[model samples]
Target: MNTPCDIPALQLSERSFGLLRSLFEKETGIHLRGEKRHLVIGRLQRRLEQRGLHDFESYCALLQQPHETQERQHLIDALTTHETYFFREPAHFQHLREQALPNLETRPLRIWSAASSSGEEAYSLAMTLADTLGPDGWEVFASDVSACSVWQAIQGLYPQQRLDNMPKGYLKRFCRRGQGVYTGQMLIHADLRARVNFFRHNLLADDNKLGEFAVVFLRNALIYFDATRRGQIIGKVVRHLRPGGYLYLGQSESFSEPLTSLEYLGGSIYRRPSCPAIARST
Candidate 1:
Protein backbone atom coordinates (compact mmCIF):
# COMPACT_ATOMS: atom_id res chain seq x y z
CA MET A 1 0.00 0.00 0.00
CA ASN A 2 1.31 3.45 -0.90
CA THR A 3 1.04 6.18 1.69
CA PRO A 4 -0.31 9.62 0.69
CA CYS A 5 3.12 11.26 0.88
CA ASP A 6 4.80 8.37 -0.95
CA ILE A 7 3.17 9.35 -4.23
CA PRO A 8 4.45 12.68 -5.50
CA ALA A 9 1.84 15.29 -6.39
CA LEU A 10 0.77 14.55 -9.96
CA GLN A 11 -1.65 16.58 -12.10
CA LEU A 12 -3.91 15.14 -14.74
CA SER A 13 -3.23 16.67 -18.16
CA GLU A 14 -6.20 18.30 -19.92
CA ARG A 15 -6.42 15.56 -22.56
CA SER A 16 -6.12 12.78 -20.00
CA PHE A 17 -8.69 14.38 -17.70
CA GLY A 18 -11.14 14.79 -20.60
CA LEU A 19 -10.63 11.16 -21.59
CA LEU A 20 -11.29 9.89 -18.10
CA ARG A 21 -14.23 12.24 -17.61
CA SER A 22 -15.89 11.16 -20.85
CA LEU A 23 -15.32 7.50 -20.00
CA PHE A 24 -16.84 8.00 -16.56
CA GLU A 25 -19.92 9.71 -17.98
CA LYS A 26 -20.34 7.08 -20.70
CA GLU A 27 -20.18 4.25 -18.18
CA THR A 28 -22.00 5.80 -15.18
CA GLY A 29 -23.89 8.94 -16.37
CA ILE A 30 -21.87 11.04 -13.93
CA HIS A 31 -20.64 14.21 -15.62
CA LEU A 32 -17.33 15.43 -14.34
CA ARG A 33 -17.12 19.04 -15.42
CA GLY A 34 -13.89 20.96 -16.01
CA GLU A 35 -14.04 22.30 -12.47
CA LYS A 36 -13.81 18.75 -11.07
CA ARG A 37 -10.36 18.17 -12.57
CA HIS A 38 -8.60 18.33 -9.24
CA LEU A 39 -11.24 16.13 -7.59
CA VAL A 40 -10.82 13.48 -10.27
CA ILE A 41 -7.05 13.60 -9.86
CA GLY A 42 -7.26 13.34 -6.09
CA ARG A 43 -9.62 10.36 -6.21
CA LEU A 44 -7.84 8.34 -8.91
CA GLN A 45 -4.18 9.05 -8.07
CA ARG A 46 -4.03 6.27 -5.51
CA ARG A 47 -5.59 3.83 -7.94
CA LEU A 48 -2.89 4.59 -10.48
CA GLU A 49 -0.15 4.20 -7.88
CA GLN A 50 -1.63 0.94 -6.61
CA ARG A 51 -1.67 -0.44 -10.12
CA GLY A 52 1.98 0.60 -10.51
CA LEU A 53 1.13 3.02 -13.28
CA HIS A 54 2.95 6.33 -13.69
CA ASP A 55 0.23 8.67 -14.91
CA PHE A 56 -3.43 9.11 -15.84
CA GLU A 57 -2.62 8.35 -19.49
CA SER A 58 -1.48 4.84 -18.66
CA TYR A 59 -4.55 4.33 -16.44
CA CYS A 60 -6.84 5.38 -19.31
CA ALA A 61 -4.97 3.07 -21.68
CA LEU A 62 -5.42 0.10 -19.36
CA LEU A 63 -9.15 0.81 -19.13
CA GLN A 64 -9.51 0.71 -22.92
CA GLN A 65 -8.33 -2.91 -23.18
CA PRO A 66 -10.85 -5.75 -23.57
CA HIS A 67 -11.99 -7.73 -20.46
CA GLU A 68 -11.23 -4.80 -18.16
CA THR A 69 -14.77 -4.71 -16.91
CA GLN A 70 -13.79 -5.10 -13.26
CA GLU A 71 -11.11 -2.43 -13.64
CA ARG A 72 -13.67 -0.03 -15.10
CA GLN A 73 -16.01 -0.74 -12.21
CA HIS A 74 -13.22 -0.09 -9.74
CA LEU A 75 -12.63 3.25 -11.43
CA ILE A 76 -16.31 4.17 -11.13
CA ASP A 77 -16.34 3.15 -7.48
CA ALA A 78 -13.26 5.25 -6.79
CA LEU A 79 -14.80 8.35 -8.36
CA THR A 80 -18.22 8.01 -6.73
CA THR A 81 -19.01 10.52 -3.99
CA HIS A 82 -20.49 8.54 -1.10
CA GLU A 83 -21.16 11.56 1.15
CA THR A 84 -24.32 10.78 3.16
CA TYR A 85 -25.59 10.57 6.74
CA PHE A 86 -28.58 9.21 8.62
CA PHE A 87 -31.49 11.60 8.13
CA ARG A 88 -29.16 14.24 6.70
CA GLU A 89 -32.07 16.14 5.19
CA PRO A 90 -34.44 16.19 8.17
CA ALA A 91 -37.42 17.78 6.40
CA HIS A 92 -37.75 14.95 3.88
CA PHE A 93 -37.98 12.32 6.59
CA GLN A 94 -40.42 14.49 8.54
CA HIS A 95 -42.64 14.78 5.47
CA LEU A 96 -42.49 11.05 4.85
CA ARG A 97 -43.51 10.40 8.44
CA GLU A 98 -46.20 13.08 8.59
CA GLN A 99 -47.61 12.95 5.07
CA ALA A 100 -46.54 10.17 2.70
CA LEU A 101 -46.66 7.17 5.00
CA PRO A 102 -50.19 7.95 6.16
CA ASN A 103 -51.52 8.31 2.62
CA LEU A 104 -50.01 5.16 1.13
CA GLU A 105 -52.73 2.58 0.42
CA THR A 106 -50.58 -0.36 -0.51
CA ARG A 107 -50.46 -3.36 1.85
CA PRO A 108 -46.70 -3.83 1.70
CA LEU A 109 -45.63 -0.20 1.33
CA ARG A 110 -42.42 -0.12 -0.73
CA ILE A 111 -39.86 2.71 -0.67
CA TRP A 112 -36.76 2.94 -2.83
CA SER A 113 -33.62 4.73 -1.71
CA ALA A 114 -32.56 5.15 -5.32
CA ALA A 115 -29.02 6.36 -4.62
CA SER A 116 -28.39 4.90 -1.20
CA SER A 117 -24.76 5.50 -0.27
CA SER A 118 -23.34 3.21 2.37
CA GLY A 119 -26.88 2.57 3.70
CA GLU A 120 -27.60 5.71 5.72
CA GLU A 121 -30.64 6.90 3.76
CA ALA A 122 -32.06 3.39 3.31
CA TYR A 123 -31.72 2.58 7.02
CA SER A 124 -33.27 5.93 7.86
CA LEU A 125 -36.22 5.05 5.61
CA ALA A 126 -36.51 1.68 7.36
CA MET A 127 -36.62 3.30 10.79
CA THR A 128 -39.32 5.75 9.77
CA LEU A 129 -41.41 3.10 8.01
CA ALA A 130 -40.95 0.62 10.84
CA ASP A 131 -42.09 3.24 13.32
CA THR A 132 -45.01 4.53 11.30
CA LEU A 133 -46.13 1.38 9.47
CA GLY A 134 -44.88 -1.28 11.92
CA PRO A 135 -42.31 -4.02 11.35
CA ASP A 136 -44.09 -6.10 8.72
CA GLY A 137 -45.82 -3.24 6.92
CA TRP A 138 -43.02 -1.92 4.72
CA GLU A 139 -39.98 -2.73 2.58
CA VAL A 140 -37.01 -0.54 1.54
CA PHE A 141 -35.06 -1.27 -1.60
CA ALA A 142 -31.66 0.42 -1.94
CA SER A 143 -29.53 0.63 -5.04
CA ASP A 144 -26.23 2.29 -6.01
CA VAL A 145 -23.89 2.25 -8.98
CA SER A 146 -20.99 1.51 -6.66
CA ALA A 147 -20.66 -2.16 -5.76
CA CYS A 148 -18.58 -1.28 -2.68
CA SER A 149 -21.34 1.01 -1.46
CA VAL A 150 -23.98 -1.68 -2.04
CA TRP A 151 -21.85 -4.14 -0.04
CA GLN A 152 -21.61 -1.70 2.86
CA ALA A 153 -25.37 -1.15 2.72
CA ILE A 154 -25.85 -4.88 3.18
CA GLN A 155 -23.46 -4.92 6.19
CA GLY A 156 -25.45 -2.13 7.93
CA LEU A 157 -22.62 -1.37 10.36
CA TYR A 158 -21.77 2.28 10.89
CA PRO A 159 -19.69 4.49 13.13
CA GLN A 160 -21.53 5.99 16.11
CA GLN A 161 -21.04 9.53 14.82
CA ARG A 162 -23.22 8.74 11.84
CA LEU A 163 -26.15 8.29 14.21
CA ASP A 164 -25.89 11.71 15.87
CA ASN A 165 -28.56 13.26 13.64
CA MET A 166 -30.91 10.26 14.01
CA PRO A 167 -33.75 10.53 16.51
CA LYS A 168 -32.89 9.13 19.94
CA GLY A 169 -35.88 6.81 19.96
CA TYR A 170 -34.95 5.41 16.58
CA LEU A 171 -31.32 4.97 17.65
CA LYS A 172 -32.41 2.95 20.64
CA ARG A 173 -35.19 1.04 18.92
CA PHE A 174 -33.55 0.09 15.62
CA CYS A 175 -29.83 -0.19 16.34
CA ARG A 176 -27.45 -1.64 18.93
CA ARG A 177 -24.44 0.20 20.36
CA GLY A 178 -21.15 -1.67 20.20
CA GLN A 179 -19.26 -2.61 23.36
CA GLY A 180 -15.62 -3.30 24.25
CA VAL A 181 -13.96 -4.88 21.20
CA TYR A 182 -16.46 -3.25 18.90
CA THR A 183 -16.48 0.18 20.51
CA GLY A 184 -17.44 3.37 18.66
CA GLN A 185 -19.60 1.47 16.19
CA MET A 186 -23.32 0.79 15.84
CA LEU A 187 -25.11 -2.00 14.05
CA ILE A 188 -28.66 -1.55 12.78
CA HIS A 189 -30.96 -4.09 14.46
CA ALA A 190 -31.11 -7.31 12.47
CA ASP A 191 -34.86 -7.08 12.02
CA LEU A 192 -34.64 -3.53 10.66
CA ARG A 193 -31.64 -4.48 8.55
CA ALA A 194 -33.57 -7.41 7.16
CA ARG A 195 -36.32 -5.05 6.04
CA VAL A 196 -33.97 -3.30 3.60
CA ASN A 197 -32.64 -5.04 0.46
CA PHE A 198 -29.51 -3.67 -1.24
CA PHE A 199 -28.56 -4.15 -4.86
CA ARG A 200 -26.17 -2.75 -7.48
CA HIS A 201 -28.03 -0.69 -10.07
CA ASN A 202 -26.87 1.71 -12.74
CA LEU A 203 -29.52 4.37 -13.23
CA LEU A 204 -28.22 4.97 -16.77
CA ALA A 205 -28.90 1.35 -17.76
CA ASP A 206 -32.18 -0.25 -18.84
CA ASP A 207 -32.48 -2.86 -16.11
CA ASN A 208 -35.51 -1.61 -14.12
CA LYS A 209 -36.32 -5.01 -12.59
CA LEU A 210 -36.52 -3.52 -9.06
CA GLY A 211 -40.29 -2.98 -9.56
CA GLU A 212 -42.57 -0.05 -8.80
CA PHE A 213 -42.33 1.84 -5.54
CA ALA A 214 -44.85 3.85 -3.56
CA VAL A 215 -42.16 6.43 -2.77
CA VAL A 216 -38.79 6.85 -4.49
CA PHE A 217 -35.98 8.81 -2.87
CA LEU A 218 -33.56 9.71 -5.65
CA ARG A 219 -31.87 12.42 -3.63
CA ASN A 220 -28.56 14.17 -4.14
CA ALA A 221 -27.47 11.88 -7.00
CA LEU A 222 -28.90 13.95 -9.84
CA ILE A 223 -26.57 16.92 -9.42
CA TYR A 224 -23.77 14.96 -11.09
CA PHE A 225 -25.55 14.45 -14.37
CA ASP A 226 -25.99 17.01 -17.16
CA ALA A 227 -29.46 18.24 -18.10
CA THR A 228 -30.22 15.68 -20.83
CA ARG A 229 -28.99 12.74 -18.79
CA ARG A 230 -30.73 14.03 -15.69
CA GLY A 231 -34.05 14.20 -17.52
CA GLN A 232 -33.49 10.74 -18.97
CA ILE A 233 -32.76 9.29 -15.54
CA ILE A 234 -35.84 10.92 -14.00
CA GLY A 235 -37.97 9.52 -16.84
CA LYS A 236 -36.66 6.02 -16.10
CA VAL A 237 -37.18 6.38 -12.35
CA VAL A 238 -40.69 7.75 -12.86
CA ARG A 239 -41.56 4.64 -14.88
CA HIS A 240 -40.96 2.58 -11.74
CA LEU A 241 -42.90 5.03 -9.59
CA ARG A 242 -46.50 3.96 -9.09
CA PRO A 243 -49.30 6.38 -9.88
CA GLY A 244 -49.81 8.86 -7.02
CA GLY A 245 -46.39 7.82 -5.69
CA TYR A 246 -44.04 10.43 -4.27
CA LEU A 247 -40.61 11.21 -5.70
CA TYR A 248 -38.04 13.06 -3.60
CA LEU A 249 -34.99 14.86 -4.91
CA GLY A 250 -32.22 16.58 -3.04
CA GLN A 251 -33.13 20.10 -1.97
CA SER A 252 -30.53 21.46 -4.39
CA GLU A 253 -31.49 19.35 -7.40
CA SER A 254 -34.21 20.10 -9.98
CA PHE A 255 -35.50 18.87 -13.33
CA SER A 256 -35.07 21.18 -16.32
CA GLU A 257 -38.00 19.70 -18.22
CA PRO A 258 -41.59 19.57 -17.04
CA LEU A 259 -42.90 16.01 -16.43
CA THR A 260 -46.50 15.72 -17.53
CA SER A 261 -47.15 12.74 -15.26
CA LEU A 262 -45.83 14.43 -12.09
CA GLU A 263 -46.84 17.54 -10.21
CA TYR A 264 -44.50 19.50 -7.94
CA LEU A 265 -45.51 19.03 -4.32
CA GLY A 266 -43.02 21.42 -2.62
CA GLY A 267 -39.72 20.99 -0.73
CA SER A 268 -38.16 19.05 -3.60
CA ILE A 269 -41.05 16.59 -3.69
CA TYR A 270 -43.21 15.58 -6.68
CA ARG A 271 -46.23 13.32 -7.07
CA ARG A 272 -47.23 11.17 -9.99
CA PRO A 273 -50.85 11.85 -11.02
CA SER A 274 -52.94 8.87 -10.01
CA CYS A 275 -54.55 6.85 -12.76
CA PRO A 276 -58.31 7.29 -12.97
CA ALA A 277 -60.42 4.49 -11.52
CA ILE A 278 -62.65 2.42 -13.83
CA ALA A 279 -66.35 2.10 -13.18
CA ARG A 280 -67.98 -1.35 -13.14
CA SER A 281 -70.72 -2.10 -15.74
CA THR A 282 -73.89 -3.17 -13.94
Candidate 2:
Protein backbone atom coordinates (compact mmCIF):
# COMPACT_ATOMS: atom_id res chain seq x y z
CA MET A 1 0.00 0.00 0.00
CA ASN A 2 2.93 2.28 0.60
CA THR A 3 4.24 3.02 -2.86
CA PRO A 4 6.71 5.88 -2.75
CA CYS A 5 5.30 8.71 -4.81
CA ASP A 6 7.32 10.99 -7.03
CA ILE A 7 5.87 14.21 -5.74
CA PRO A 8 6.72 16.23 -8.82
CA ALA A 9 5.44 13.64 -11.26
CA LEU A 10 2.30 12.75 -9.28
CA GLN A 11 -0.88 13.16 -11.23
CA LEU A 12 -4.59 12.98 -10.48
CA SER A 13 -6.25 10.88 -13.12
CA GLU A 14 -9.58 11.99 -14.58
CA ARG A 15 -11.42 9.17 -12.77
CA SER A 16 -9.76 10.01 -9.47
CA PHE A 17 -10.47 13.70 -9.98
CA GLY A 18 -14.13 13.08 -10.73
CA LEU A 19 -14.51 10.79 -7.72
CA LEU A 20 -12.84 13.31 -5.45
CA ARG A 21 -14.77 16.28 -6.73
CA SER A 22 -18.03 14.44 -6.24
CA LEU A 23 -16.99 13.09 -2.85
CA PHE A 24 -15.91 16.50 -1.61
CA GLU A 25 -19.14 18.04 -2.86
CA LYS A 26 -21.24 15.30 -1.25
CA GLU A 27 -19.49 15.62 2.09
CA THR A 28 -18.83 19.35 2.32
CA GLY A 29 -21.21 20.93 -0.21
CA ILE A 30 -18.28 22.60 -1.98
CA HIS A 31 -18.37 22.27 -5.76
CA LEU A 32 -14.85 21.87 -7.07
CA ARG A 33 -14.91 23.04 -10.66
CA GLY A 34 -12.29 22.04 -13.22
CA GLU A 35 -10.10 25.05 -12.47
CA LYS A 36 -9.73 23.90 -8.86
CA ARG A 37 -8.11 20.63 -9.91
CA HIS A 38 -4.64 22.11 -9.76
CA LEU A 39 -5.47 23.78 -6.50
CA VAL A 40 -6.54 20.42 -5.08
CA ILE A 41 -3.38 18.74 -6.35
CA GLY A 42 -1.18 21.41 -4.80
CA ARG A 43 -2.98 21.39 -1.48
CA LEU A 44 -3.07 17.62 -1.28
CA GLN A 45 0.39 16.92 -2.61
CA ARG A 46 1.86 16.93 0.88
CA ARG A 47 -0.84 14.55 2.08
CA LEU A 48 -0.16 12.14 -0.75
CA GLU A 49 3.56 12.37 -0.08
CA GLN A 50 3.06 11.85 3.62
CA ARG A 51 0.99 8.73 3.03
CA GLY A 52 3.70 7.43 0.74
CA LEU A 53 1.02 6.94 -1.85
CA HIS A 54 2.17 6.97 -5.46
CA ASP A 55 -1.00 8.43 -6.88
CA PHE A 56 -4.23 10.25 -6.07
CA GLU A 57 -6.00 6.90 -6.53
CA SER A 58 -4.22 5.39 -3.55
CA TYR A 59 -4.93 8.46 -1.47
CA CYS A 60 -8.57 8.35 -2.45
CA ALA A 61 -8.69 4.71 -1.40
CA LEU A 62 -7.41 5.67 2.03
CA LEU A 63 -10.09 8.33 2.33
CA GLN A 64 -12.87 5.96 1.28
CA GLN A 65 -12.11 3.51 4.06
CA PRO A 66 -14.39 4.10 7.03
CA HIS A 67 -11.54 3.55 9.48
CA GLU A 68 -9.37 6.20 7.85
CA THR A 69 -11.08 9.03 9.74
CA GLN A 70 -7.88 10.95 10.36
CA GLU A 71 -6.70 10.55 6.77
CA ARG A 72 -10.13 11.60 5.54
CA GLN A 73 -9.87 14.65 7.75
CA HIS A 74 -6.52 15.53 6.20
CA LEU A 75 -8.15 15.48 2.78
CA ILE A 76 -11.00 17.67 3.99
CA ASP A 77 -8.52 20.03 5.61
CA ALA A 78 -6.50 20.34 2.46
CA LEU A 79 -9.52 20.99 0.28
CA THR A 80 -11.81 22.99 2.57
CA THR A 81 -9.36 25.19 4.41
CA HIS A 82 -8.49 28.58 2.98
CA GLU A 83 -5.96 30.93 4.57
CA THR A 84 -7.25 34.05 6.29
CA TYR A 85 -5.54 36.89 8.14
CA PHE A 86 -6.37 39.33 10.88
CA PHE A 87 -8.93 41.98 10.01
CA ARG A 88 -9.18 40.63 6.47
CA GLU A 89 -12.20 42.91 6.08
CA PRO A 90 -12.10 45.74 8.59
CA ALA A 91 -15.55 47.04 7.73
CA HIS A 92 -17.41 43.95 8.99
CA PHE A 93 -15.69 44.17 12.35
CA GLN A 94 -16.29 47.90 12.35
CA HIS A 95 -20.00 47.25 11.93
CA LEU A 96 -19.88 44.74 14.76
CA ARG A 97 -18.32 47.34 17.01
CA GLU A 98 -20.40 50.30 15.86
CA GLN A 99 -23.83 48.86 15.13
CA ALA A 100 -24.34 45.24 16.29
CA LEU A 101 -23.28 45.79 19.88
CA PRO A 102 -25.73 48.63 20.62
CA ASN A 103 -28.92 46.61 20.16
CA LEU A 104 -28.52 43.45 22.20
CA GLU A 105 -31.50 41.93 24.03
CA THR A 106 -29.74 38.76 25.08
CA ARG A 107 -27.68 38.03 28.18
CA PRO A 108 -24.26 36.34 28.15
CA LEU A 109 -23.88 37.64 24.59
CA ARG A 110 -22.31 35.29 22.06
CA ILE A 111 -21.03 35.64 18.49
CA TRP A 112 -20.37 32.90 15.97
CA SER A 113 -17.57 33.07 13.42
CA ALA A 114 -18.69 30.49 10.92
CA ALA A 115 -15.91 29.02 8.80
CA SER A 116 -13.38 30.78 10.96
CA SER A 117 -10.01 29.83 9.48
CA SER A 118 -7.06 29.89 11.89
CA GLY A 119 -8.78 32.14 14.47
CA GLU A 120 -7.90 35.61 13.17
CA GLU A 121 -11.49 36.74 12.65
CA ALA A 122 -12.59 35.24 15.95
CA TYR A 123 -9.72 36.79 17.87
CA SER A 124 -10.27 40.10 16.16
CA LEU A 125 -13.90 39.97 17.24
CA ALA A 126 -12.78 38.95 20.72
CA MET A 127 -10.61 42.06 21.03
CA THR A 128 -13.42 44.28 19.77
CA LEU A 129 -15.94 42.73 22.15
CA ALA A 130 -13.52 42.84 25.06
CA ASP A 131 -12.88 46.50 24.44
CA THR A 132 -16.53 47.46 24.17
CA LEU A 133 -18.37 44.82 26.25
CA GLY A 134 -15.66 44.61 28.98
CA PRO A 135 -15.44 40.78 28.66
CA ASP A 136 -18.02 39.59 31.20
CA GLY A 137 -21.16 39.26 29.09
CA TRP A 138 -19.76 38.09 25.73
CA GLU A 139 -17.80 35.31 24.06
CA VAL A 140 -16.83 34.44 20.46
CA PHE A 141 -17.38 30.89 19.20
CA ALA A 142 -15.63 29.94 16.00
CA SER A 143 -15.83 26.79 13.90
CA ASP A 144 -14.34 25.43 10.69
CA VAL A 145 -14.79 22.13 8.87
CA SER A 146 -11.06 21.51 8.79
CA ALA A 147 -9.67 19.83 11.88
CA CYS A 148 -6.24 21.19 11.02
CA SER A 149 -7.64 24.69 10.78
CA VAL A 150 -9.46 24.32 14.12
CA TRP A 151 -6.25 23.08 15.69
CA GLN A 152 -4.26 25.98 14.31
CA ALA A 153 -6.89 28.42 15.49
CA ILE A 154 -6.78 26.91 18.97
CA GLN A 155 -2.99 27.36 19.05
CA GLY A 156 -3.34 31.13 18.53
CA LEU A 157 -0.05 31.37 16.65
CA TYR A 158 0.60 33.09 13.32
CA PRO A 159 3.38 34.67 11.33
CA GLN A 160 3.71 38.38 12.17
CA GLN A 161 3.28 39.27 8.52
CA ARG A 162 -0.29 37.99 8.58
CA LEU A 163 -1.11 40.60 11.16
CA ASP A 164 0.07 43.50 9.01
CA ASN A 165 -3.52 44.35 8.19
CA MET A 166 -4.27 44.45 11.91
CA PRO A 167 -5.11 47.82 13.34
CA LYS A 168 -2.24 49.73 15.03
CA GLY A 169 -2.73 49.38 18.82
CA TYR A 170 -4.34 45.91 18.76
CA LEU A 171 -1.01 44.20 18.12
CA LYS A 172 0.54 45.55 21.31
CA ARG A 173 -2.58 45.21 23.44
CA PHE A 174 -3.79 41.74 22.47
CA CYS A 175 -0.72 39.88 21.17
CA ARG A 176 2.96 39.43 21.88
CA ARG A 177 5.72 39.46 19.28
CA GLY A 178 7.69 36.25 18.90
CA GLN A 179 11.32 36.23 19.96
CA GLY A 180 14.26 33.87 19.44
CA VAL A 181 13.17 30.91 17.28
CA TYR A 182 9.85 32.58 16.57
CA THR A 183 11.20 35.94 15.46
CA GLY A 184 8.92 36.47 12.47
CA GLN A 185 5.78 35.10 14.11
CA MET A 186 3.37 36.27 16.79
CA LEU A 187 1.19 34.54 19.37
CA ILE A 188 -2.18 35.87 20.37
CA HIS A 189 -2.11 36.97 24.00
CA ALA A 190 -3.34 34.19 26.27
CA ASP A 191 -6.03 36.40 27.74
CA LEU A 192 -7.53 37.18 24.36
CA ARG A 193 -7.17 33.57 23.24
CA ALA A 194 -9.08 32.40 26.29
CA ARG A 195 -12.12 34.48 25.42
CA VAL A 196 -12.52 32.86 22.01
CA ASN A 197 -13.50 29.21 21.57
CA PHE A 198 -12.43 27.24 18.49
CA PHE A 199 -13.93 23.96 17.31
CA ARG A 200 -14.46 21.87 14.18
CA HIS A 201 -17.92 21.85 12.62
CA ASN A 202 -19.17 21.46 9.09
CA LEU A 203 -21.75 23.97 7.89
CA LEU A 204 -23.29 21.30 5.68
CA ALA A 205 -24.72 19.62 8.76
CA ASP A 206 -26.82 21.13 11.59
CA ASP A 207 -26.90 18.37 14.24
CA ASN A 208 -24.40 20.21 16.42
CA LYS A 209 -26.20 22.88 18.37
CA LEU A 210 -24.28 26.10 18.82
CA GLY A 211 -26.47 28.45 20.82
CA GLU A 212 -27.95 31.55 19.20
CA PHE A 213 -25.74 34.58 18.88
CA ALA A 214 -25.99 38.35 18.57
CA VAL A 215 -23.95 38.24 15.35
CA VAL A 216 -22.62 35.59 12.97
CA PHE A 217 -19.53 36.12 10.82
CA LEU A 218 -19.98 33.68 7.92
CA ARG A 219 -17.73 35.17 5.30
CA ASN A 220 -15.85 34.30 2.11
CA ALA A 221 -16.32 30.53 2.27
CA LEU A 222 -19.78 30.69 0.71
CA ILE A 223 -18.43 31.66 -2.68
CA TYR A 224 -17.16 28.11 -3.24
CA PHE A 225 -20.53 26.41 -3.03
CA ASP A 226 -23.31 26.30 -5.63
CA ALA A 227 -26.44 28.31 -5.02
CA THR A 228 -28.46 25.39 -3.64
CA ARG A 229 -25.71 24.43 -1.24
CA ARG A 230 -25.27 28.07 -0.33
CA GLY A 231 -28.94 28.30 0.48
CA GLN A 232 -28.80 25.17 2.63
CA ILE A 233 -25.72 26.39 4.48
CA ILE A 234 -27.16 29.85 5.05
CA GLY A 235 -30.47 28.38 6.11
CA LYS A 236 -28.73 26.32 8.78
CA VAL A 237 -26.57 29.25 9.89
CA VAL A 238 -29.37 31.79 10.17
CA ARG A 239 -31.28 29.58 12.60
CA HIS A 240 -28.45 30.17 15.06
CA LEU A 241 -28.69 33.92 14.76
CA ARG A 242 -31.39 35.31 17.03
CA PRO A 243 -34.13 37.38 15.51
CA GLY A 244 -32.73 40.92 15.30
CA GLY A 245 -29.20 39.47 15.31
CA TYR A 246 -26.84 40.39 12.47
CA LEU A 247 -25.16 38.18 9.86
CA TYR A 248 -22.06 39.28 7.95
CA LEU A 249 -21.21 37.67 4.63
CA GLY A 250 -18.24 38.36 2.41
CA GLN A 251 -18.68 41.60 0.45
CA SER A 252 -18.82 39.62 -2.79
CA GLU A 253 -21.31 37.07 -1.45
CA SER A 254 -25.09 37.23 -1.39
CA PHE A 255 -28.17 35.00 -1.75
CA SER A 256 -29.63 34.06 -5.11
CA GLU A 257 -33.02 34.27 -3.49
CA PRO A 258 -33.67 36.39 -0.39
CA LEU A 259 -34.93 34.96 2.87
CA THR A 260 -38.08 36.48 4.28
CA SER A 261 -36.57 36.74 7.77
CA LEU A 262 -33.32 38.41 6.72
CA GLU A 263 -33.25 42.03 5.68
CA TYR A 264 -30.25 43.22 3.73
CA LEU A 265 -28.37 46.03 5.32
CA GLY A 266 -25.58 47.43 3.15
CA GLY A 267 -21.93 46.30 3.19
CA SER A 268 -22.90 42.61 3.17
CA ILE A 269 -24.56 42.91 6.56
CA TYR A 270 -27.99 41.34 7.20
CA ARG A 271 -30.36 41.22 10.13
CA ARG A 272 -33.12 38.80 11.09
CA PRO A 273 -36.50 40.42 11.43
CA SER A 274 -37.11 41.47 15.04
CA CYS A 275 -40.68 40.14 14.88
CA PRO A 276 -40.81 36.80 13.14
CA ALA A 277 -44.15 35.07 13.07
CA ILE A 278 -42.41 31.93 11.90
CA ALA A 279 -39.03 30.58 10.86
CA ARG A 280 -38.16 31.27 7.21
CA SER A 281 -36.01 28.93 5.16
CA THR A 282 -33.88 30.34 2.31
Off by over 4 Å in 1: 1-6, 276-282
lDDT of each residue in 145-207, candidate 1, tens digit only: 998899988998899987899999999999998889869999999998888999999997877
lDDT of each: 0.87, 0.85
Tell how far residue 217 is off in model 2, in angstroms.
0.5
- TM-score of candidate 1 versus the correct structure, residues matched by position: 0.92
TM-score of each: 0.92, 0.92
lDDT per residue as tens, model 2, 97-156: 888898885878889999998888899889888888886888889999888899999999
Residue pairs whose backbone atoms clash in candidate 2: none
Worst 10 residues of 1 by lDDT: 273-282
| TM-score, candidate number 2 | 0.92
